[model samples]
Target chain A: MNMVVCIKQVPDSAQIRVHPVTNTIMRQGVPTIINPYDLHALEAAMALRDRLGGTVTVLTMGPPMAATALRKALGHGADRGILLSDRFFAGADTLATSYALTSAIQKIGESRPVDIVFTGKQTIDGDTAQVGPGIARRMGLNQLTYVSAIPTIDQEAGEITVHRRAEGGVQVLKTKLPCLITMLEATNVLRRGSLPDMLRAERAEVETWNAEAAGVEDIGKCGMKGSPTKVSKVFAPSPRAEKAKMVEGDTAEAKARVAIDALAETDPQLLSVIARQPALAS
Target chain B: KSKELPEHLKAYKNVWVFVELEHGRVHPVSWELLTEGRKLAAALNVDLAGVVLGPSGEGTDSAVAEAFHYGADRVYLVEDPLLENYRTDPFTKAMTDLVNTHKPEVLLLGASTLGRDLAGAVATTLATGLTADCTELAIDPNRNMAATRPTFGGSLLCTIMTQQARPQMATVRPRVMAMGEPDRSRSGEVVRERLDMVEEDIVTKVLDFIPDADSNQAQLAFADIVVAGGLGLQKPENIKLVKDLAAVLGAEYGCSRPLIQKGWMTADRQIGQTGKTIRPRLYIAAGISGAIQHRVGSEGADQILAINIDPNAPIFDFAHHGIVGDALEILPALTEAFRQRLAVDRLAG
Candidate 1:
């Protein structure tokens, strides 16, 4: 089985800072990490490869610096890393992104047909769980999104069963191979790299593919030209006239009393929830 | 604007909202999407239509009727046995084929799991633009639908517009939009369609559905009083303080996104842009740094009480009331005080 896992490099949110005056994200010096959700996908893929006897290839579409992300994956037992980087892929929205990724995956399959494709439920930067389904649609693969568990897979039979997270429950579904899965975050923990894999990550060369080399047949469909959605304006949410009033007290108990008193004046409904009494006093 | 489209694209005529019917019940977000669809359609002077697709008896008929009650001028119905369950292949094909047949100027769906799954597939199949998790939608002066959503990890909001795409597409955040009163007397025309695909062609099958136990699921989104702790609580064990306070007040307790990432809390208990958008009457946030992402989800609360060790924490900026103190200590103190106060109030009253 050949499994391809899609990952992205996103700014570490914990380290992200907002501008004091402008209230916009100050991203200049922030370091990037492989998207947290993607780690679950990578782990799921690697776990399957470990059990099912196959290779796990980590793939990413980003700038040249994105090779660092692939190396991170390689450090975590990935058999290979492929970077799809090109100026033509810049400013691509979900549609063009899926197309570009599908093109690269197809090219990868030229050597060995991919049995399963994996992606995180969504990227923190975009928070749009569209690209995975988009890729599945373009590649004619069955889409299993928000998958929590892959209980069974029969490689020769080309059959698989998964537990998918729906709105209110888990849908235990059976599907065929050559499918795309968007792994839900927190379903599995990423493994720490072994010493051998960690050393290999430093020495291994990541294969970087440009648009043409990645078999992008149409240049127009790779970037902004292919993306119909355009960002018209970016702005900060307007703040209220006054900031939160500092409720102060000499002690924590006083502070709680003051805050509670203030909340009573502002939202009596909430106050009643806590202290509402029956008509027993009457 | 519809007139300017080339001959092939000119048929796109009305605004369509996908009514999410699953397991014989309608998601609250479906009604919310229709609420916004009405406004968008009125702004563009187009009909507000609902696309309700499911099995014949499993809430499909009721969904069609409710669509009109929720302000849909017409309802497009597609009932098939294969549609009883939401399989990506059949749902996407049916939705895409319908969109191609009856061109809609703007299409909206809830950003729920099912809606996102189907919308992404259909939008890609149709080769159109789709803005996900939109918090705002409006009509541009050029008559295109302008969709606004949080971007750059929720620090900034961006307005997206589909240029030259016949049917502008967007998925709205579930609780952001206000749902209006439904008029029971409302009636509308129903357009019927069929899912031509068959089970034999489908690659996936639903073997069974296991519902999450209600006792385990957190009802944080609709909680009237919510108390959530953040990283300032130091570690997972300290979460007990938050629970103690919530227990006293009989409130649902949640945590920030980082806790979920850290495995300290379940995903359902997270309050942030990526998690549930809570509309509680009063929300008490403890030790939270108040990232813009967290702010987006909690800002809708009628009143916010923030407690943090750092006076400059951004949570204080938007919170209605602030206490610059350690939540670890303050939470326990607040709990004790509130307990005594309630007891005293009850005895006096």
Candidate 2:
């Protein structure tokens, strides 16, 4: 059971701040890390590999610096790392990104068969949970998204059962092998790399594949040209003209009282609604 | 180079909304899309239709009728038992088949779990582009559908267009669009379609469904009053303050995305673009800096009270009422004040 986990190196969004005047992202000095959600995906793959006698291959498509992310996945017990970086892949949207990554996965499959392909539910930057489905569709694999748990995997039977998170409940789904799975966040805690794993990861020779090596058959579909959806414009959200009505008080308690008073005065119905609650009446 | 819509693809017309139905009830987002779809259809000078796919029963029939009541000029029905529980394989096949046969130019769906899951598969099968979680939808000058959504974690908005794809697809999250009134007297044409797939061919099988227990779940989307905490609370124990305030106000409590990621709050209690799109009358946000994702979900509230130690927290920009103090301290104070006020009012009564 060989698994391939896709990860992305993204700017830490928490530290990212928009400039006050320019309203542009201040990228200076901000550190980059493997997407938090993808860490969970990587961890899931590693856990499966540990349970079953198999190898987990980590894959990423980005700039040369993206190799760092792959190495980090190696540190977390991935068997191998592959970085598909090319100038042609720049400015690719979800569709184009999936195409490039899927092509690389195909190229990887030429050498070794892939039983399962794993991806994060979504990237923090993209937040569009489309890539996993796109890759699955392109490769003709069944997609199990928002998957919270992989309860069992029958390699001999070529089947896997997973608990998928849906709108109002959990759907326990059984799907065939050779499927694509997008892991939901907080499903499992990520494991830290031990000293030997860290050392091996630091010295690991990360495989670098260009567009041609990645077996991208169509150059047109590799980047912006292949992307059907185009971003026409990007702009910051306009601020509201009226700032928050500042409730002034010398102390936190005083401020809380004043805020509550102001809220009650503005919306008296709130109090009446509270009074109607049977639990509150007691 | 600008490519024109090929002659073969130019035949695609009409704007269709996927009327989502589950457990014999229609999700309100379907009506919301119909309302917005009506505007887009009118803009494109095309017919507005609703596509309802479900098991053959009263649920499917009512969904088709309700589609007509909610401004759909026609309804496309694909009734099959395979679509009863919304396994991706059958729903995707049914939807893609309908699109390929009917050739609607614009397809809309709610960004709910089912819609997102189905839309991706359909769009990919059709080899078309799809924009998810769109906040705005309109027809561009080129007559193509322009879908605008938050990008880069909601720091910026980007308008995306399917340059050369037929049946331009987009999914708008629930509550983003305003729901229109249903004209019960209105009726639409019902075009029933047959899905050829059987249960065995579908790769995935639903073993069981564990319905979310109402006792522990947060109904933040429909709550009248909501008190939410963010990472600013600093500790998991501080969540009690937000809950206390919500208890006194007889409201529901939720948290920001970070809290959920940190495992401090459950996924259902998360209020954001990805979680629940809430339209509460009064929303109290504590220790939240109002990131774009969290802001989009809570901005629909009639009144927002934000408390953060950082005076320059982004939450203040849109929040109606703000307190520049530590939420850890302020939340307890607010809970105490609300408790006292409620107790006094009870005694007076």
Candidate 3:
């Protein structure tokens, strides 16, 4: 089996802070890590590779600095890492990003046929969840998103079965290979890299490919030029008058009671909830 | 400024919202988008329509009725058992075909698992732009639908527009927009179609569907009252206090995204930009700092009561009422008071 997992180094969104005065995001010192969801995707791919004799190739589309992320994935037992980064690829939207990624996936398939492609449900920074489907459309691949588990795969028959998270239930879906899977979060815990794998990954030569090298034929379709969605404005959500009338109570118990009273006073529905849920009132 | 459409896209006129239904129940998000779609249609001075694609049954019929009740001027219906479940192939083909036959200036879908799946596929197949998780929708000065959504992890908001695309696409979460009462007297035009594609042509097949009751799922997003804790709970076991309070009030319990990150709770219980965006009647938050990301997710709540050790925590700024105290001691006290105030029939696990 030949599988490719797409990963991106994103800012640790949880640690990102906002400036109190300017109300602008403080991305200056924000450290980047593999998108948390992508870690799940990588783990899924690695597990498949470990169970079925195969190799997993990790891929990314970022700046030259993204090579660091690729090296880290190698430490997790990926056989190869390809970095598709270029000045022309900057300011790309989901459409352009998918175009570049689709080209890169095709180029990677030149040597060996890639049966499956994996990506996180969405990137933390962008959070669009569109790139994977766009790649599938361009490459004519089966797109399985929000996939919780892959139970079975018939390589010879090009068939795969997966559990998909739907609106109100789990859909057991049977699709074909040459499919793209976007792994949902909390499906599996990521594994620790072995000492030998870590050592080999640290010194591994990361192959960095620019737009041309990555088989991007049209420069116009590579970046901002190809992006149809135009961002006209960027601003912060205006804050309300910042003040909280602190509930007066010396002890925790007094404060808790006073707070609940105030909430009921404001939204009587809070207490009416008990009457509504006959089970609670019973 | 007027939006100039090319010769190809000039035929695009009305605004359309996808009416998402499965298992005979329409997702509330679809109605919310329709309520929003009404505005965009009025602004564009065009018809507000809905596309109901599903198995031929009460699901599609009532969805069409509610679409009109929610102010749709017309509805395009595609009914087939093959379209019963949400598979990418049939849904995409049905949607793309509708757009090709009758051009629409704007198309909206909910940002649920099904919506995101079909929207991405349809937009790509039609070669259009799709903005995800939009917070606001309006007709801009240029006569295009300006879809404003969060970017860079919800720290900033950006407005995007598909300048040249025929049908500008966007997705919004369920509770982000307020839905008005439906008018049952309203009715409109219905265009019925069939699924041209065959089941054998579809590669992906649905084997079975295990309902939500089969899993230990947290119903946090739609709860009327929600009590949530943050890292301030300090220890894993302290989460019991949150559960206790939720049990007394018959409310759902959730946590800030970090608790999920720390494995203290399941991912479904996380309330944040990347998790579930909740719109409860009364949200009691304890030990949460209420960062912008968390704020974006929970701001939809009608009233928020934040309890934290720091009075300066940002949560209080937006939270209606607040108490500055340690959640460790406060959660137990609050749970006790609520337990006595509302005698509950069941105790939490």
Candidate 4:
């Protein structure tokens, strides 16, 4: 199996802060981490490589600095890393993003017949879980999204069975190989690479591909120009003016009472809730 | 190659919200979108319509009738059992057919699991742009549907526009928009549409739906009050403090997406981007370093109280009130405080 995992570099949301006067995120100095969700996807791919006897390649489309994420993927047991960086790829939405990625995958496929493509369920920055599906649609890869478990793999039969997170339920689906999968969080635990893996990753030369090198023919379809959607503005939501009625009391029991009383007046439906559920009262 | 619409095709107007039904029950998110769509429709000075696709029969009629009561001026109904199980192939075909036949300026769907799935497929089929999980939607002065949603994982808000697209599309998370009162006497014109595609063409089959276990499911969407903790809780065991606080406040307990990602909290109890959208009376965010993704999910809360040791936390920007304190210390304090206050109030009453 020639497995490919896509990763993204994002600002650590924990340390991300907004300027008081500007009301915009102070992104300049904040450190970036390989998106936590993508780490799970990379880990899953590496595990499959180790178990099935295959090579794992990590791919990313971002600024040149995103090579750091590729290095991190290499450090975590990936065999090779490719960075698709170009000025034309900036400000691409999910559709345009999928185009660039699909074109790059096609380029990579020229060298190796790709068996599986892995992506996080969604990126923290994009938050739209559409790219995985978008890429699958473009590449005609069988998309298995929100996948919780890769229960079994029939290598000889060229098929894989997975547990998917559907609405209000789970769906167990079996599909053929050469598919795109977006792994749900916590599906598999990421493994720590040995000292040799870390040392090799630090010294490994990552291959870079520009749009032309990635087989992107129409530059218009690779970035913001190809994206039909445009973000017009972003602003802080209007703050609520009313203050919370701070309730004070001595004992935990008494405090519960005050809070419940406020709940009764503010959200009166809660009073009936307390009346109905005795477990809540005590 | 002119992709521009002919003058005749450009006459289509108004905004439409697809009233989604599953297993014979109308999803509550439909009503929420109706309330939101009504506002957008009024602002755009166009009729607010609903497109209902289900098995042709009593249930379909009732769903369309309910749409009128919820402020839709008209309801487009397509009755077919093939539409029964919310299949992507049939639903997408039905919706796109409606859009092609009677074009709407803006289309809205609830950002539920079903809505997200259907919206993406349908939008792609139509080759139209779609903004998913929009926290806010409004008509710009140009009458374009301006969809404001969180971007960069909810660290920032991005207003997206689908230029040159006839039907601007967006999906809103459930509970983020308020549902208006149902005026049962309200009436609307209902048009029955036909499905030309047969069931055989649909490739994917729904073998079965294993319902979520009761223990694993959290009714966070409809919970009136939510108490959620973030990394500030310090240890996984400290999550008990969140449950205790929620108990005193009569609120459901959840956590930021990280806690869920970290396996510190159940998937259902995660409250942020990719988790659940909650619009509670009060949302007490403790130790949560509100990322744009998390903030977008909870920004709809009527009252947001943020408690964090670092006053510089982004959660404070949208929080109704901010307490510069340690969550581990303040949580116990607040829990104890609420517990006592509630007891005295009950005694006084």
Q: DockQ, per-model, please?
A: 0.54, 0.57, 0.57, 0.30
Clashing pairs in 1: none
The 10-residue segment with the lowest total lDDT in model 3 chain B: B340-349
Winning model by lDDT:
1
Models ranked on lDDT: 1, 2, 3, 4
Give the TM-score of chain A in candidate 4: 0.91
Q: Model 3: per-residue lDDT, tens digit, B1-349?
A: 3347777888899999999988888988888888999888888889999999988888778999999998899999998999888899899999999999999989999999999999999988888899999999999877788999987777778788898887999999989987768999999999987778888999888899988773647778878888899988889999998988887777888999889889999778889887789998989899899988788989999889898999889898999888998988888898887766555422421
lDDT of 1 by residue, B135-221 (tens): 899998778888999876677787888967878999987788878789999999999988898899898999999988775588888
- Model 2, TM vs. native: 0.91
| Better candidate number, 2 or 3, judged by DockQ | 2
The CAPRI class of candidate 3 is: medium
Candidate 1: docking tier: medium
Docking class of 2: medium
lDDT of 2 by residue, B24-117 (tens): 7798999999999999999999999999989989988889889999999999888889888878788888889899999999999988878888
lDDT of 4 by residue, A1-282 (tens): 898898888887643445668666677977888888788889888888778988888999999999998998899889999999999999888778888999998888898888899999877666777777777767767667777888788899888887778767887767778888888877778889889999999998899999999999899887878777887765554454544444445544444445445555766555444333333645
Residue A47, model 3: Cα distance from true site in angstroms: 2.1
Q: Write the per-residue lDDT of candidate 4 for residues B1-349, one digit (tens) a residue.
A: 2435446646769989989887777889999999999998899888999999998777778888899999999999998888877655678779989999888988999877678767866676666678988878877766677888866666566689886666878988788789999999999898888888775665445556677887536878877678999999889999998998887766788999778868898788888766788887678888898876687678878667777777677777777666666678778877876666566657866
lDDT of 2: 0.88
> What is candidate 3's CA lDDT for residue B211?
87
User: With candidate 3 superimposed using the best TM-score fit, by how many Å does residue B254's alpha carbon deviate from the native?
Assistant: 1.9
Show what share of the native A-B interface contacts model 3 retains.
0.75
Global lDDT for candidate 1?
0.89
